[model samples]
Target: DMTMVLRVIIRNRLSENLRHRFLLNEPVDVILMFGQIMQRNSFTLMCSSLRAHHCPDDVNNPVKEVCPQDTDSRDGFIFARDIPDRSTQSYRVQFRSLILEKKLGDALAIHDKIVSKDKRLIDRSAYNILIWGCGKYGYSRKAYELYTKMKESQLAPSNVTYTSLFNSFANSPYKSESLKLCEKVLRDVKKFDINLNYINYHAMIKAYGRCGDILMAFDLVDEMMSKKIPVNSETISFLLQGCLSQTESGFILAIMIWGKMKQYRIPRIIQHYNLLLRITKSCGVKEAASLHVFLMKNPTFFLPISLLDTESNASENTSKLLPITKKSRDDSAFSNYDSPEKRYNGLGGLDGLLAMMKKDKIKPDIKFFTNILELVPDCDTSENEILNAMSINKVQPDDVFLCMLMKKRCSYNNYEGAKEVLKLFNEYNVKLNVLVYGILATTCRTANDAKMYLESLDSNEIRLNVQILGCMLNNACRSLDYQYIIYLMKQYKIHKITPSKQCLKSLANAHKRGRQIELDIDNNVDVPKKLRQRIKRISYKHFVMSYRPWIKLVRNSEADPWEQFTVKYEDD
Candidate 1:
């Protein structure tokens, strides 16, 4: 029975990862995760999310004790203030819930308040939770302060505590100091005999990567592989991200690191492709066109199994180099090119862009056309061309134009431009849609803001769809907003929308990391580890993922959709 359960869990995770490589699930957080610029931005987002969820409203009001009557039903947002029972058991549950909601501030505030009022410190578990929260949000200074308190209480720091401590310093700005701190942590890990299971090394690699110590980062990655530490896509992602366009020679190094994924048998993912794209973006046209054309033509590269990758690399190596690459974009000779089409950019600009299109022999798909429209001289002419090409959808040409414009603006993080385009959509009588909202959500810096935008859209009576919900769900997952994930799942089921694969994968990733924490309370009310895990899995399968098989959901003279889903799936 245990083996079968384990098999089911592994299969679910595999399916989830496979779906993630599709890259159709467009969320800004996923995009930023691959980009080097997001390291500090992510830390900032984590901090801001906590602040947004936290209001300074007085907490003196009496609250009712609404602890879950059933152990299995004890899920969702439960704040510390809501629990009148001030026992350690209730506090631990609330602390984890707050971490899930990304509310580290309130969690710490409540912890301090309780300790000060009661004239005693909490247990190691509470301190560990706070330290983990601090590390997660780049609160290295605060994490060390709590570590001191943990020692003062004579608590033996577990691997979790050490791992969070290492991770908390992942964003240290000093190069040599960061390296020295990382070395010291490693020595401590050994001295304390903390079996961190290689997570500490990952934190170290991230620390090195942030400080531009690419060599050290790769050395640690190679160390993990040499020792067979079960490296995942995230580990390689850090290595590749470290090679992100820092020096002029970064492109070459990025390729070598890119090759390492295949060497180690690590699956290529969307983030891997994005990292390469971001690095190749700075190279000359000849270097970029080969990869871009191939990727644009064959998007399956976004998935694990990329086709003709070797050929693409060969094409890139052999492509004709433009001498204009050495010249500035505005150089007189380079700018005054006699080509029929105006230069879109320096290396090849429109020339390279079109060349890529022609070389690949790809037809004008809607999305591909949207990319092209940005290069066109006249929006009206592009709008007409887009309309004729996409007329089958029956959407107004102006609507398409407005949506494309908004997407272009949102791509550049131009929230103001997107808002203007939205006004134009209203003025032109174009019905706002999921596409518009999805694009706008890209500009939202934090999940809380995204949630509000989604809620306002709901108030406007715009029925949500798979794209909007999936977009929000993916973003919430990226921000680690457990409450928003629940909200998104509820909205999907309430609206009767079938769970799209993208959304399912996002949901699966969210629930995959189950915490089987042991509680210290003597009360029988505390949830058991095994039972808690079982509930999390069951809830994900039956409630969140909508695990209804075909034979039961569709049954009207053997024809109705209701009988299509039944108990057979469970039996199987």
Candidate 2:
């Protein structure tokens, strides 16, 4: 019946008239006719139908092939099979074709039927199909579910399964669930004895990094090292990229990774240079320079081609029966080259370095200049040295470099010198930001001149921020100006500035002091209750009036005998 139905379907596809007459005439009626044909003598009709319409070509025709001459007689049948079992192979191909066509349900049905008919036919390919199918249909749950079933069915998961599962989870929507799956794999690593190679580790690291879990990525690296798995250039490169997203820790981790690379004899690649360049820029130019010096000292460790080229060439020539003289010439040429400088010069230094780089045929890009600009000046000599280095290297200083120089000058309290730097920024047309004002405000605070500090605040060219307010409040408090305190509170309320605790305390103290002065000036004749209570609450020693002066004056004035005076000491 299966053969007959398959033949009818094929015939319908081959001829439009046949399809219209039998299959498409009336969907329900055609189905009824086919059912009647199948219900009556179905197996015999299937064989006859297949023989007539679906007979194989000569290559696959079993009738044309000769049977084995030697036949072993069983109880009721003769058996002499020369061909190895191809049942699983036929089912596998069919399953793959179904999967390719995106007919997952049909593929699953066929797979189950094949496995039921011949349990021995359930192989790795079969499991892979099911897993891949489940993944394709957005059925990660089903895919994992099938993996458990495969394990229970005593089928071993191939590397392909592991790779697919990892990739599936790499961008999975359910990140928490995906991480759980990753943990499961790690826990069962020993049981499966799955060797997580470089690719596996890289994928896992990338996945964890994408999820913003830098610690997990680092842990994976440690796991690889503990297992004695040799880290390759790509692996280290990937780890470094992940580290770049971290804050300060990225630089420290990058240095550690680079050290590991050197320890493992893994030669530095272009990516390694780029990563180190970025790390140095973020960490500081000094750190970058230190790394560069280390690289220069161990040139052979990093420049593998230069180190092994002579030997490689010699072996090649020897294999061809050539003389060894050519190898020496090659070695001498490579050995005479100067080691590439690793020290990071600031932007100006980079310009000089760029000239040298050009001489060496290395075309530097904008990123190279940016890296130099970001280096924090570590000492007094750093700026000039960086400038000299750039000039010597013939690197052209850009606008960004000028801005960075100005920032450095401002940071070091060299505002007088910063004028020239600021001039450069203007010359380069660099837009000024609020940070420039912050720098100026901070400088004013250091100068400790309230006039200059206030003048800086009045500038319309630069925007004032909370830090400026804080500086003003601090200056006012130190000067103990009651009028300034009142002015600041009014300004704060009008401008919607949030007063800090220090500002609030300073305002309250100023108010208390003002009230005490008012009370002192008023005659000792019964003061207003509100004014008396305010003066009483003035605990600050400087604000509290000495009762001895008031008592002596009161007694001298011949106050009533029933009137009492009380004195209490308050800590400052």
- What are the RMSDs of all candidates, in order? 27.0, 24.1
Q: Write the per-residue lDDT of candidate 2 for residues 1-572, one digit (tens) a residue.
A: 55456546646543454346444423222322233233333423333333334344524534222133432222222222222222243345555776687766666655554455324456777788776765554444545766777788888887777655655554555656766776676566558788777677777776565444656776776777777776677877777776665543455345445445544566656556566567655542123233334434654332222212233422221222212222332223222111212224321244454454454355554445445545635445667766666666566666556655665676666877677766655654676665555545534432245446556557655544555666566555544543343344445545555655565566556556555556674757565665455445433233334323432432455532112211121211
Evaluated against the true structure, the overall lDDT of model 2 is 0.51
For each candidate, what TM-score against the reference? 0.40, 0.33
Q: Which stretches of candidate 2 lie over 4 Å from their true place?
A: 1-123, 126-146, 212-216, 244-248, 273-572
Tens digit per residue, CA lDDT, model 1, 145-206: 78878888899888788778767766543345545666666776678776556776777777
Model 2 lowest lDDT segment of ten = 562-571
Clash pairs, candidate 2, are 292-342, 348-390, 349-390, 351-395, 352-390, 352-393, 352-394, 352-395, 353-393
lDDT of every predicted structure (CA atoms): 0.52, 0.51
- Candidate 1 regions off by >4 Å? 1-87, 114-119, 171-184, 245-249, 281-572
Q: Best TM-score goes to which candidate?
A: 1
